[model samples]
Target chain A: MTDITIDHVTKNFAIDGRSVTAIDDISLKFPSGSFSALIGPSGCGKSTLLRLVADILAPSAGKITIGGTPPDEARRRHEIGFVFQDASLLPWRSVMDNIALPLEIAGGPIGDGPRPETLIRLVGLSGFENAKPAQLSGGMQQRVSIARALVLRPKILLLDEPFGALDEITRQRMNMELLRIWQETGTTAILVTHTIGEAVFMADQVHVLAAHPGRLVTTIDVDLPRPRALAMLQTPAFNHLENAVRAALFGDELKAEPEPAHG
Target chain B: MVGPVVFVVVLLALWKLAVTAFAVPPYIMPPPEAAWTAFLKEADKIGYALFFTLRNAAAGLLVAFVLAIVLAAIFVSSRKVTHAVLPIVIGLRTAPVLAIAPILIMIFGRGIGTAIAVVVIVSFFPIMVNAMKGFSSTRKNALELMHVLGAGWFKTFIKVRLPFALPFIFAGLRSAATSAILSAMLAEWLSGAPGLGTLILDASSYRKTGLLWAAVIVSMIMAYTIYWLTTAVEKRLTAWRN
Candidate 1:
């Protein structure tokens, strides 16, 4: 029910009397309950695309639908949640406060069900409920942000570089954690990232975008099994996929240019 | 090198030493002992004036808080108006409150009203500017979170913007509160309103240096209490700042 459809979406920004196209005529459909990644270089509109779908930014043309309704309307009905590159945890709020923010603003939960304890335990931040975002490390903060996004039982979650700020070890762990959460929750999630390995490792479908008026260049189906372990990176198929995605992104450009002079 | 109480003790010691060393006349430079004695002797009169001035200062601060919030709401709601009027507000802030107090007194007349007016002008601008900064720069992620959470504008404004605005607003208020108390006394000085400033003025004119020093001490204590109270509230509310 939470399938997202973006049809001919475009975004343009006018800055200092100059018009700059951020995203141009990109159309795609994300099947229900699937993990997808929009991957590209910096300034390639991956983030912009997620923002458009989040209703944080409206597309200049075309239409976006989340669960058959406008993205903005869906957002307002608590049908979707969006996470940003920064943790975006309120510095003035505790982990519990941050997670409960959606409920708090909606004038408390009207549901007969108990509060979101599964999300709390999922992030492995059970003991840090009262702790503020500032007290936690960056990895811990990102975990809190993930918990916050999931608090309202959102059907579709959009993440924009949520782990881009973490160290490699933390990022890898978070990648695994995200897979676990996706499998458990069955939420249709979309991630925007610049890392090639990350896209192949986590996404069910990786949509590569070209920069400077960003448009979809290719869509690579991951075709990998669910609940993938970190050790899968040792597999030849994983290596082939990672290499292919990387080569598609950068290797060909380097090959086209001549080699540097020998030292 | 010194704790807060220790610093105060040091200051008191230095003041006593200066008066004693100079052998200054009791009428010209009363000793600290003499000042304390005078303070106790005129405790009733001093207490009334202190209470009155504090009441005005508190009222002035409250008014400033409400006004700053309303004005900041207006400013943030429109970027064009904010860009145009912000400079003017800053310009008014730069103008000294002491220089403006007499003109305010002439307009409002000499009373607690004039004193409150003086304090308001001294305290309002900074608090407002801070509120404006805090509200306008609400994190895009937070805003999106609120939006997706089905929060109405009122809910987002109250729960998010208000709480976010608090630290900066408190910072501005903490600064402004001190100015409010000081300038309340100063306004009394200019307008002949009945407070510690008037007491100091009266004591000085009568060459009662002991009373003058005593009133000044009372004034300092008042300022310290306001600072401590605001600081305590700030710490409690911003426990997340840890």
Candidate 2:
């Protein structure tokens, strides 16, 4: 449970003898014990920014201080956990083994411990201990990945479209499940998503990034209410926030179009 | 039973028809009934020979399995060595096993050991190549999951990488099993105590074409048995794939 402060984070990728800027001069701060959603149109560097915070990719310029230390330092000591859009659970590993992966990597005594049993229950994967990834459904497999990321008990969890591959019904159920898990665990989550409704439903703050030399366009705080149910999505307040996020994205798309031939 | 049984029946019928149509002498080509009668009369000898070849085939397959896995592990652990040595391994696979059998016989003599060695050499390449390809085919997402979870290189290899490679390795084994039986018989033709190869040679020398046809049938059964055994193992190990 800690804050992640990004100070002028910029990312450049080397491609075909040219450097392409993915994220440019973006400064954002995610406070402690809060669920923040990074919402943006595709290719707006939302994933790139999340990867930088997860320490998977280093920024070409600028610094990110995670929990008062560099993400590089944070990740190595296993202070941050990350999940990709793909469930990414090892096909060969059973659910228990997948969940126990962090402990195995951390190289500690793996025995009857209080935390391990509690974690299995927390994810609602009680009877699926021996089930392999291939044996489970898409939703169940994603749950294993989530359990694995949280196994290390990191303060910050970074997710890059973790439910993008699941069906709409599954995704909605997952959002509810995720909220339940977060409420119980109190771990700060930074979810990078494209769904405006999802952003409004999940986040305390939704940070929107606009493309074409990608940078943050706006940040909107959702003071809607706590324990936000799926039913809240149809409310006027949710509609208002969704419209705001939609307008911000629409404005960016409008600006990105090639201008009509001028004299 | 479905495809191969139909294939064997068609093949035997064609051979019988050719023998009758050409008016081929009994010593040259025996009819299906005569071949069947000869096969029953000499069942004990054929059975013994079949057992001998099977023993050699099983031994060879085991040897090839061990060697292929070790080589694959070595190649995977060190990329530079794999890049350096892979072409030569592919070249070995290209060399026909029959072409090399006599040369191997000259070196090791026409004994069971030579027969086993020939089968091992013949079968090793496919297993090694399949294992390499299977391990490398591990999904990138699966790997990232392991990495983020803190699984080390060896742990990742055994738990994640190895199980994923099982289907491919078994596929190679199923393919190699056929070659394994063929190579063992080829080696037995050159040397060995008393296998189907010896029966074939004795029948050919005595002008007993019917007995030779029977020996051929026994050997075919031996080869298919290996194939089916491997296929069964494949089915059990990779029930998840289906």
State which candidate has the highest DockQ.
Answer: 1
Error of 1 at B80 (Å): 3.5
Estimated TM-score per prediction? Answer: 0.90, 0.82
Q: Mind sharing the TM-score for model 2?
A: 0.82
The candidate scoring highest on lDDT is 1
Q: Would you list the C-alpha lDDT of every candidate in the order shown?
A: 0.85, 0.83
Candidate 1 local lDDT, B49-142, one digit each (tens): 8887888899889988898888897898888998898788778778876687768888989987888787877899888988988898787667
Clashes within 3 Å, all models in order: 0, 0
Model 2 over residues B83-107: C-alpha lDDT tens digits? Answer: 9988887777788866776787788
Lowest summed lDDT window (length 10), candidate 1 chain B: B140-149
The CAPRI-style docking tier of model 2 reads: acceptable
Q: For all the models shown, what interface RMSD does each have?
A: 1.8, 2.4
